[model samples]
Target: MATCAAPSESDAPGHPDRSRDDRWAASGAQLRALVDAFRSEPVTPARTLQFEHDVQIVVRELGRQVVPFRYNQVEPAAAVDQPRHARFEHETYTRVHAKTRQNVWTVFGQLVVRRIGDRPSQAGEPMLFPRAHRLGLVHGASPALAARACQLLAAAGANQQQILARLRADHGVGWGVKKWRPVSRAVSDEMGVYRHDAQVDQLRTWLAAAGASTGRHKPVVCVGRDGITLRLRMKRGSLYEVASTSTVRVYDRRGTRLGTVYLAYAPEPGRPAMRGALTAVIRDVLTRWEGPVPRWCDVTDTGDNETGYDDRVLRRMTHPRTGAALAWVRVVDYYHASERVWALANMLFGDNARAVGWAKTMLTWLLLPGGVNRVLHSAAAFRAARTLTRVQKKEYDRAYAYLRNRMSHIDYATYRRVGVPLGSGGTEAACKTVFIQRLKLRGMRWAKDGAQTILNLRVVFLSGIWDVVYGRVLAARPQPIMGGHVAAEPNELEIAA
Candidate 1:
C-alpha cells in the first residue's frame, strides 16, 4: 500500500527558507513571549480583552510579513519557457519589474505582497506573478475569502450587512457591503457552469458504477412541484409586481429528500417554456439511476396547465440514451381538491353550519373507494334541489368541471393503500424553505438577473450541494495575472496557504 508523507516545515508558508531547528527556536521564542505576556496580567475581563487584541495584532503583522516571502519563493523567474502552439513560435517571458506591491484581502486579514513580476515578450500584454496568481490573489480578495463570503450569503441566507458583520465578528476580517456584494454576485453568476458541471459529474459516476456491476436496485422517486409568488420591482412604477417561482422537490423511497431545483423568472415563461424546464430537471434526476429504473409519482395541485404539462411533457419524456419513458403516476393534491369542494358547498349553501357539514360530507366521499362518482352524483343532486343565484350557479359549474376533469387522478383509496402520497405537502413546504424564507423579506425587490442568481444559489444551498457548486465556481474563475504575462508553474506550489 502506498502511504502519503506529511508536509515538512520548509513546505509551509513563511518557514520555506528556515531550517527545522531554526523553526523550533522561533516557535520557542514566540511561546515564551506569550507566556510572559500572560504572566504580566491578572485573570480579569480587561486582561482577557487585552490578550485578544494582542493576538489579533500579532496574527495580522505575521500575515503581512510572511505573505511577501511566500510569494517570492514561488515567483516565476525571468525568461521562463513557454509551450508552442500551431500558429505561433515558442516564446519566453522576461522579468518586467524586480518588485511590485499589491494588496489583497484574506481570511487572515489584508496581506500585502511585494514581489518580482514577469511579462511576455509581446507588447501590450499584462504582467504575471506565478505564486500570487496560483493563490487566486490577483483580484479584489483571495478566492478563499470570496468562497467564504459566498458560503455565508448562500447558506446563511444573510443580507449584505449581516455578512459583513459576521465576517468581522467571527473571522476578524472587516469588509463593507460594497466590497462583499460584487464577490457574491461574481460567484452566483457562475450558477449555470456549476450546475452543468455537477450534473455531468453525477452522470459520469453513475455510468461508471453501472459498468462495474456495482449498482443497487433503484428506490422509488417522488416528484413534487409547485409555484410561489415573488414580489419584484417594476421598471415603470415605485411598487413591485408579482412574479412566480416554480419549484420541484425529489425524494427517495424512505422519504429522504434527494434534491430541490427551482426556476424563478419574470414575465412568466409560457406553458411550453415551463414544461421544458421541468422536463430537463426530471431527465437529469432519472439519468443517474442504476439497476432498475425507479417508478415516478407527481403530486401537484389541479392547475389546468400544470396538469396538462405534466401529462403531455413530463410523463411522455424518454431517456435520451435508453429511450425508456418515465412510468409516472399522476396525483391531484387532496387539500386543493377539498378546497374546491368546500367552495362549491359554500356557494350552494351559504357559509354557515350547513355548508361546513356538506363540505365535510363531500370530502369524506372523495376519499373512499368509488367515492369520486358518488361525490359528483351528490353535487349534481344538491345543485338541482337548490335554486342558486347566477354567481352560485357559476361556482357550481366550476366545481363540477374541476372534479370531472381530475376524476382519473383522484384515486385516493389505492394511493393510500400503496403508500403513494395524496397531497403536495412536500412541495408546499419547499416553497417556504427554498424561496419564501429567503426572498420574500420586507423591502426585498430584485432585478431579473440578480433574482435568478440568488435563486440558483438558494436551491444549491438547500439541496445540500452548496459546497460542490461553490468549489466548481471557484475553480472556474479566470486565471490570475500579474505584471503583463500569464503565470506558468515551474513546479506546483501550495496555493491553499
Candidate 2:
C-alpha cells in the first residue's frame, strides 16, 4: 500500500499526450456509441414527459448551495455572515443576466433606447426604424433596387451615396424612390410589395388584350401606282376636319420610285376649306394604297358645296380598263414630265441616267409570260371572281364586279429571287420611327406650337434632324415650357450617399 504499484497505463496522470493504441480504442468506442444513439428507437411521448419530470426533480433538489470563506482579518461576526452576503451577491448576478438586460442586439444596432408603455408593457413601443418603413420613405429606391445598388457599390468600391446618385441620374429619382437604405445583411426580408403588384397588373392587361383581339380580316390591297393612303385630322380649336391624303411616294419591287402623286384640290372661288377638304381626300387615298397599280385615283372637288363635283375624274383613273385611263407614257397626263422622271430617277439611284437605263430594262422584263395571265376571264367568270377573298386577288375590277386584275406587274417568284420587300414598310417604318420615338412618351400631352417644333426637328433629324436639332436648341435656351410643363431641372444637391 505504501509503495502503490507504479500506476498502470490506464491510470496515468491526465496529460494530453496519448499512446496510439489507447486513442484508437477510445475513438472506436465513441463511434459505436454515436451509431447506437442514432439507431435507437424514438422516445414515446409518455417516456419523454417522464424524463422531463425527472430532470425537473433533479434540478430542484440541487437548489442553491453557499459556503463561507471569510479567512481575511475581519471581525468574527462578519466571517459568520459571509454566506448570507454571498447569497445576495448571486441574486444580483442572476437578475442582471436574466431579467434586467438593458441592451438587446438588433438589426440597426445594440438597441440603446426603448420606450415601454405607461404600465411597462410591449404596447405603444414602435419597432424603431423598421426595415420596411426605412426602405421606402427615406430611401431613393425600393428595398430590392437598393440592395442591387448596394451590391454594385460594394463591387465598385464606392459608397452607398455614389451608387444612389448614379441610379438617380440613369433612371430619375421619382422612378426609383423607395430603395435608399444602409447596406443590410437581411435585405431579402425588406422587399416592397407594390413593385410585384404592378408587374402582375401589366401582365393581366396584356393577356386581356390578346384574348379580345382575335378576328381574321382580309388584307386590303389597293391597286395604285403611287401613294399608300393614311387618315389624318386637321383641327383648330373646336372645329376639326377628319380627312385623308395621298401625298405619298410609291416604290416598285426593287424599291425603285414609281411616282409621287400630290393630292391637290379643285380650284374654286371663295371656298378655301372645301378645296382643302378635297386635297385632304386625295392625300388620304394615296396614303392608303396598298400596292403598285396603274389606276391610282386623286380626288378633286369644285369649291361650291352647292354641287358635288363629278367623281368621274377619279373613277376613270381608278378603272384603267375603261379606255378613259391615261397611259403614264402619255405626255398629257403629266406635269413637267421630263423633270418629274428625272427626279424620280435620282431618288431611285444616285445617277439619274443609270436609273433611267435600269427602268427601261425593267419595262422589257415586264412583258414576259410570268407577267401575263394564263387564263382570260369571260364576263361571267369576271363577276364570279369578285366573290374571291380580297387578299387572294391582287386587284378588283372597279367597272365590272368580277373582272379583277393583278396589282404588281412583276412576277413574284422572280421578284423573290431578287430581294424585294412585299410591302413598302421601309418608308412607313422610317416615318413612325422618326415621329413616334422622338415625340411620343407615356403620359405625353402636346400643345400645338411645341409639338410642331419637335415634330419638325424630329423629322429633320431622322431625315438627317441632327444638324437642325442641335443648331436650334443651341440657338436659344431650350424653352422651359415644352410639350406642357417646364423641362425638369438638374438637382443641385448631390445624390450620392
Candidate 3:
C-alpha cells in the first residue's frame, strides 16, 4: 500500500500548498484504508454511515488537490501567443502573483485555491484571478456547490437557517448567511442569462410532442395566470404587494396534460415583465409547431389583472411569420365561476341550506349546453321571489355582475366536450406553490431582489427544466479575456479577489 508519512495541515484554518501534496497522499491512504476496513467489517447501519463519512473526508481532500493542477493548465507557458513569463492576463495585465491563495466553499468541503492572480495598480481595486473565473469560482463558492445552495434555498419552505444546518451536517460545509446569501443570489442572477432560452426549447419540445400525439381531437395548449399577496420588507412603503405566476401546458387530444412550463415575477404594478415574457414564450412555441394549428386558449379567473393581461397581450399577439392575428379561446376558471355562484346564493339565502342547494343546482346547470344563460335566468327568478334589503341588493348585484361580465368566457359545456381545460387550477396552485409556499413562511419578509432571485429560480425548477437551465448557466462563461471574471451585471460591479 502507498503510505502517507508527511505532516498534516488539519490544524490550520487554511490549507497551504506547501503541504497539499502530502494531503493528496494522505487522502489516497485514507481511501484505501476506508475500503479495506469496510470490506473486513460485517455490514451494519452504523458501519455503513461511518464508511460514507470517511469517504467524504478523503474525497474532499482530493478535490482540494485538483485546484493547483487545474490552474497549472492555464499557466501562460502552454499558450503559443503569449510569452511564458506572462501569467494570467486581464485586458493588458501581465504582472501576477505566482500563487494567489483563495478559499472557496465546495460540496465536498472548503477548498483553498492557489491560483495565478493579477493585481490591478488602481487604488481600491480588488485582485483578479483568471483561473477562478475559468473554474466558475465566484461569490465564495464553486459552481457545483453554488448550484446545490441555490436549489436548497429555492426549495419550498426553505430558509437560510435550514439550508445551513443541512450543509453543516451532510456536506461538511459551514457557510453562514453572509456567504450563502450572496452565492445563492449570484447563481440566481447567472440563471437569468439562459433560463428563457431553455424554457423556450422545452416548450417547443412539448408542443411537438402534443402535435404528434394521436387521439380523437387536435392537440391543445392552455395558458393560465393568477396572483398571490406577498409580504415585503419594512423599507418598502407598502408592506404587502401582489406577485404573479403563469403556467403554460400542452394537452394531448385525449385531454391529458403532457407537461407544463412556469414563469413568475416579483411584485410589479402591472406585471408588464411577466406578461411580455408569457407572450413571447407562447408565440415561440406556436411558431415552431410544424403540425396543424393547435387549439390555443387562455384559462384563468376573471380578475382585472388576469383579464387585462389577456386582453392586452394574448388577444393582440400575432403570428411571427404571417403577421396574422393570433386568436385565443377564452375560458373563465370553472371553480372561480362556481365561487361567484355561491356568493350570489349566500346573499339571497343568508347561509341557509336553501342557498347551498340553490348553488349546487346552479353549478350543475352550468355544465349543460347553454348553461350560463340558464344560470342567469335562475338567478333572476330568485331575485323576484325575495324582498332584499338595500345592502343585500347591492352585494347581490356585484356578485351577479361578476358572472355576467364573464358570461361569454364561461362556456364550460363546449370546453369540456372538446377537452379544453375549464379551470385555472394549475395557475392557482402555482400562485400558492411558486410564490406563497416559499416566501410566505412565518416571519419571512423579503427585499425585492432576494424574493425575485428565489422566484426566478423557482419558476424554472417547478417547470421541470432545472437541469437544462441550470447546467447551461453554471457551465463556464465564454472566454472573454485571458483572465478575470465575467463582466458583472450592468449596475453591479465585481472586482474578484
Candidate 4:
C-alpha cells in the first residue's frame, strides 16, 4: 500500500554526470579539439582513390555476394487505379449465458463513427442494438460461474453480511461460502431460493402495521378447540395409544368463512382413548362456545372401545349455575351417526359423562321416511303410520306424539337459518387447520418448545396478525437482528446500525 509522501529535494554525491547541460558544456571544448585534430589528419596516398581501380578490377574477377532480398517495389505504375472492394472488419463471441448478452452492430458502428468524428457531426444513425447478424456471448451453467454471477448480483443488490445471513438461516436459498485453495470463497446462489432478510423484514413490517390497525377492534367471539392424541412405538418397546389434544379457534370475518387449516391437528370423530382426555376436550368446547346459547351443555363418550369408564365428563349449566353428575354408561358401539341420538344424549345428560348408556336407545330406533329415523316410542309419527309393520314399528303410536311435542317447542327447522352452535366441530376444525398445518411435517420430530413455537405462530396466523406478531416475537429474539424500537412497517427505512 502506498503511503503519504513528504516533500524533499534530490541529493547525489560524487556523480559522474550532474546534469545533461553540465556534461554537454564540459565536453564541448574537447569535441571541438577532437574535430579539429581529426580534420588535420593525413590524407594518405595508400588510402587515396588510386587504390579503388585495382579493387574494382579484382571485384569483377570475384562474384559479389548479393543478399536474396525479396520486397515488392512500390511503383506508381502510371496511376492505373482500379476499383477495390470496401474493407470490412468484424469479430464474433460464443457464450453460454446468452440471456444476459446482446448483439449491437449499430453500437459498434456508432462507436467507430464517434471515435472518428470528434469534430461535432450529427448526421449519423442513433446508436442501438441492431438486428444485424453477429457472434453471440454464451454462458453455461457451470456451478462456479453461476456462483460468481450470483456474487456480482448480490454485491450490486445487497451487502456481504446480508448474503451470509441468508446462506446460514435460509437453507432454501441458493448461496453460501466455501473454501477455495487456502482462502474462503463466497458462492452466491449455491443453495436454492432462501429467504432474504429483506423479505422477512418486509413480511414482519406488514404484519406489524396490520396489527396496529386492528388492535383497537373488539375481540370477535371465537370458538376454539384443543385435543390430544397419542402415538405408540412398537419397535422400540411397544407402548399404548396416548390421547393428544389439539385446540382450534373459529371466528367469522367479513363474508368469507374458513373451515380448517390444511394438515393440522384435529379431533377425529371416533378415536378411542382414556375418558379423561375426552372430558378435557368437552370442557374446552363448553368454555369456548359462542353462538346459540344453550340452556344446558352435555358431554358424552363417542369412541369405538370402552377400556375405561366415561364418568370423567363434566358439564356446566348457565341459568342456575349448578354442577351435575359426570355421567358414565356402557355401550355396544359408542360411535353412532344419529344426530337425534346425540341431541337426546346431550339433553338428558346435560354435559354429564354418563350418557353412554343411550347407545341402546340408538339400536332400537325405527327408520322413518325421508331419510330421517325417529324412536318408535319417542316419535309418534312412526307409530301413526299404519302401513308400517307391527313388529317393525312396535312403539309407532307414541313416536309421532313425541316428535310433535319436541318439534313444537324446539322449532328445530328454524335453527338452520340462524347461526347457532351445533357441535364443537368448528373449534375442532380450527385445531386441524391452524396447529397441525404448521407443526406436523412428515418426518419432523419436534421438541415441546419447537412445536409450541409453531403452534404459537399458527395462533398468530389465525389471530389475524401473524405477520405483525411474528415480527414482534422475532424482534425480541436475539438470534435475529433485535431492537426495542417499535416494529416498523414494510416501507419504513432500515434502523441505523
For this target, which candidate reaches the highest TM-score against the unseen true structure? Answer: 3
Candidate 3 per-residue C-alpha lDDT over 1-497 given as tens digits, one digit per residue, 9 for 90 to 100: 11222211232333335455676778788889889999996999999987887787677557655543343334432223222222233334454535545676766666554455555555566765655676677676777778887788778987769888888765667777788777777778888767778888887787778777778877888899888889888754548888888998889888888888888888898898888888888877767766677888999988898878888778888877678887689999899889889988988888999999999999999999989889889998989999999999998998789888888898899898888998888888888889777998888888888889998888878888889887887564653354244333312321111
Question: Candidate 2: deviation at residue 95, Å?
Answer: 85
By summed lDDT, the worst window of 10 consecutive residues in model 1 runs over 1-10
Error of 2 at 193 (Å): 51
For every candidate, C-alpha RMSD to the true structure in Å: 7.4, 29.5, 6.5, 33.6
**lDDT comparing candidate 1 with the true structure:** 0.62
Per-candidate TM-scores read 0.76, 0.22, 0.85, 0.28
Query: Which window of 10 residues has the lowest lDDT sum in candidate 2?
Result: 64-73
Return the top candidate by lDDT.
3
Q: Tens digits of per-residue lDDT for model 1 on 181-222?
A: 676677677765576446434433433443344223233345
Off by over 4 Å in 1: 1-72, 76-95, 115-132, 197-218, 234-250, 254-268, 271-277, 475-497
| Model 4 C-alpha lDDT per residue in residues 32-99, reported as the tens digit of each score | 55456545767566544434433332222121110000000011111122111111122111111111
| Candidate 1 lDDT score at position 74 | 63
Model 1 collision count: 8
Model 2 segments more than 4 A misplaced? 1-423, 435-447, 468-497
